[model samples]
Target: MTAPASLRDHAYQTLKRRIVEVQLRPGARLVERDLAAELDVSRIPLREALRMLAAEGLVLLVPAKGALVATFSPADVRDLFDIREVLESLAARLAAERATPDTLAPLTHRMAEARTATVSGDLRRIAAANAAFHAEIIAMAANPLLSNVMGPLAARTEWLFRLTASRDPVEQCSEHEELYGHIASGAADEAATSAFAHIAAGRELSITLAEKWSDPDFDPELIARGRRRRRVES
Candidate 1:
């Protein structure tokens, strides 16, 4: 049998999922005692998990009041996408200039996985596969410095992808395929352009959704309902 998960790991994963899915609303207080009881763990593991989430930028550790879910604003979305555009475009360019078919196999695999996930209407899987595809591109780019810079942002990027899950995953997969083709053909300029276009296409929509989700009065239940509706529609 598989080994049981550690309390800290379980708590971290559970809290992270709740936060990413908006079950734990942004700017809401996270009481240690309540969370500890809810998760059926002692305060030690709960606090450890909170610290981990804080490091990933999903939770804020206040000096006196305790932890709060991290908030996102439209400006924050734009800022993140701006950074992604520049860095990801450069990564695609480098990958195009350096990648071979073998080097790009991981991206191709991720693209296929994303397509399957989209068709199956698994939003979480789609986000994860899409993130993996990007990670592969960064790795294929062969720049350690770039990878190091991007490593910390992977979790945040996946979080953003989930918030914008209303977007057509099919279209996103298609764009990933196109970018892959450019990289495989060693067309550096085309690959860079494709990367920028892909990221830009989602930027405005993400900002709009962020505005709605970040509103103080917004209902978290709506996020779940929307995902269910999208699943049916897809």
Candidate 2:
């Protein structure tokens, strides 16, 4: 029989989801007491969860200050995308060479979901579908080493996307379709090249958006209020 999840695991997943989804924005203070009460978990498990997230680069724990959400600078964003471009290109190339119809089916389904999500005009769904599509590609690559490295990078990438929130659905869908075509056709070189180009473009866009939106002295309270307001409006 499968083992049940522990409280630490549960807290970790909950906090990680909130961070990735931007409910807990970058650089927001993580008060242990508040979080413990909010999550209805004991301090021990919550601290363990924060430690796990910190190891994954999702949370920051300072010497004097307590835990906070990880913040990405423009340079950090560029560096991450640069690494992603290299790794993801390799994944696409390997996927093209190795993927069978069974492996490719999930990607095909995710592409359709992305298209539908694009038309629905829900940014959250669009983001989720886009992530699912790329994750499927990585899974098809069949490399545990690559997946392990890409896992944390992918989480950071999703956080960046949530911050920018400016993707053009039609354009993104078009690019995804093109990439999918190369992978499905088993064109290894083409798949790698396409993946590189797609990520490079995203890197540029993310950098630009980060520069435009970033505030050096960002106020976490204001960010929290804005998020609350957006939630109510939606």
Say which candidate scores most in lDDT: 1
Candidate 1 wrongly placed segments (more than 4 Å): 1-6, 216-234
lDDT of 2 by residue, 1-234 (tens): 222248788888988888888887677778777787777788888888888898888988765546778777677788988797898999999999987899898889998998998899888778778888888889899999999988877677767767766867778889999999999999999999999998888777788877765567765444433322222000
lDDT of 1 by residue, 1-234 (tens): 222349889888988877776666666667776677777888888888888898888887766556777777788799899999999999999999998778878777877887788888988888888988898899999999999999878878888888888999989988998998999999999999999999999998999998887875644333322322111000
Q: How much lDDT does each candidate structure score?
A: 0.82, 0.80
- For all predictions, the C-alpha RMSD in Å is 7.0, 4.9
Query: Evaluated with TM-score, which candidate comes out highest?
Result: 2
lDDT for residue 173 in candidate 1, whole number 0-100:
87
Model 2 spans > 4 angstroms off: 1-5, 217-234
Candidate 1: C-alpha lDDT: 0.82
Lowest summed lDDT over 10 consecutive residues: which window, candidate 2?
225-234
Q: Can you list the residue pairs that collide in candidate 1?
A: none
